[model samples]
Target: MKKFHRDASTLVLTLISVLLLTVSALICLKALGPHGEPMPSVTDWISAVGQAVGALLTGGALIYAARTYSKQRQDRHEELEQKRQEQAGKIIVRVKHGLPDDRTSVSLTNPTNLPIFKMNLYTIDDDGQVIEGQPLSEEVVVGDYPGHAYTQRYRVHSAYAVFTDSGGVAWIRTSKGTLFE
Candidate 1:
């Protein structure tokens, strides 16, 4: 909307400038002649002024088009970045309750085709403090397919996972479904 307003103002200003120039040229021609008769070389002067105004309008149009294209390209780039960030968030961490005989488990799943590196899953309390689990010593790559699971004996309040995406961007995803870089 702001871009629209700016473009509109620019067009209005250009038109006003052209109108003033044309009126000024007509006034000059009138003042140089007697009894409102067009002076000698009047047609030549008008022709020159017309060419200058045409060039000015053409230049303004080209500049406006270039700026509009640049803005559209930038908007597309930002949209793609946002989509990438959302895809990175698809790395899921969940605490699963198993059968009566089975132990509680924490699983890290990477649904995306891209592999995530240095994945670390943690069980956190209500206060967001890490209550259980340790960071993996080696960088683990979690790919698409069956997820990696850990048998967690302790009851979990919540869970979160930290990992680097295929694009080398780091992200943190909570069990509550919040994701951020």
Candidate 2:
């Protein structure tokens, strides 16, 4: 795994270096002489460098866009695996109808001896729309998780736990703790 990361990083760095060299060459070619038929000025070099930087940025953007397709596929795969794991029964607790906007608390457990990132619970409304933080009053965190991506830390739970006093109001008493509105 370490070797894979090292190789990926090296490949990225090499690609970036090649991109920089190509952009620099193009900039130099375009700015061979001064503009407006006058000898090149100090500003010309600056402009050339700026153009090269712009080209580099454009190339990076293109690369990122190209990678997005693969990223989406990987994300879907991870999500499926997570759902299957959840179905297999992860230690989780929930507190429903605890805020004004029907806010709920869904606590998840990482029992696979691994810590996950971007672990957010998605709830669907009755109208079939994803409720964002529009009616959220304030977000609070009662705990933190500091485990590695592949390490289990039950004590350090609540990976991305957030509490926003939404529209629905209620009280909850879980085996872990009690949350009130």
Question: Which TM-score value belongs to model 2?
Answer: 0.29
Candidate with top TM-score is 1
Q: Write the per-residue lDDT of candidate 1 for residues 1-181, one digit (tens) a residue.
A: 7567656766765676667556655665554565756554867677656666765676567556656765786688789788779667677777666735565555677877667877777766546666644543227565532233434444456777788877788898887788988
The alpha-carbon deviation from the true structure for residue 86 of candidate 1, after best TM-score superposition, in angstroms, is 3.5
What TM-score would every model get versus the actual structure?
0.66, 0.29
lDDT of 2 by residue, 53-167 (tens): 8777766775665466456756787887565444223323342334344334434443443333333343334454434432222232223322122112112222222222122
What TM-score quantifies how close candidate 1 is to the native fold? 0.66
lDDT of each: 0.66, 0.44
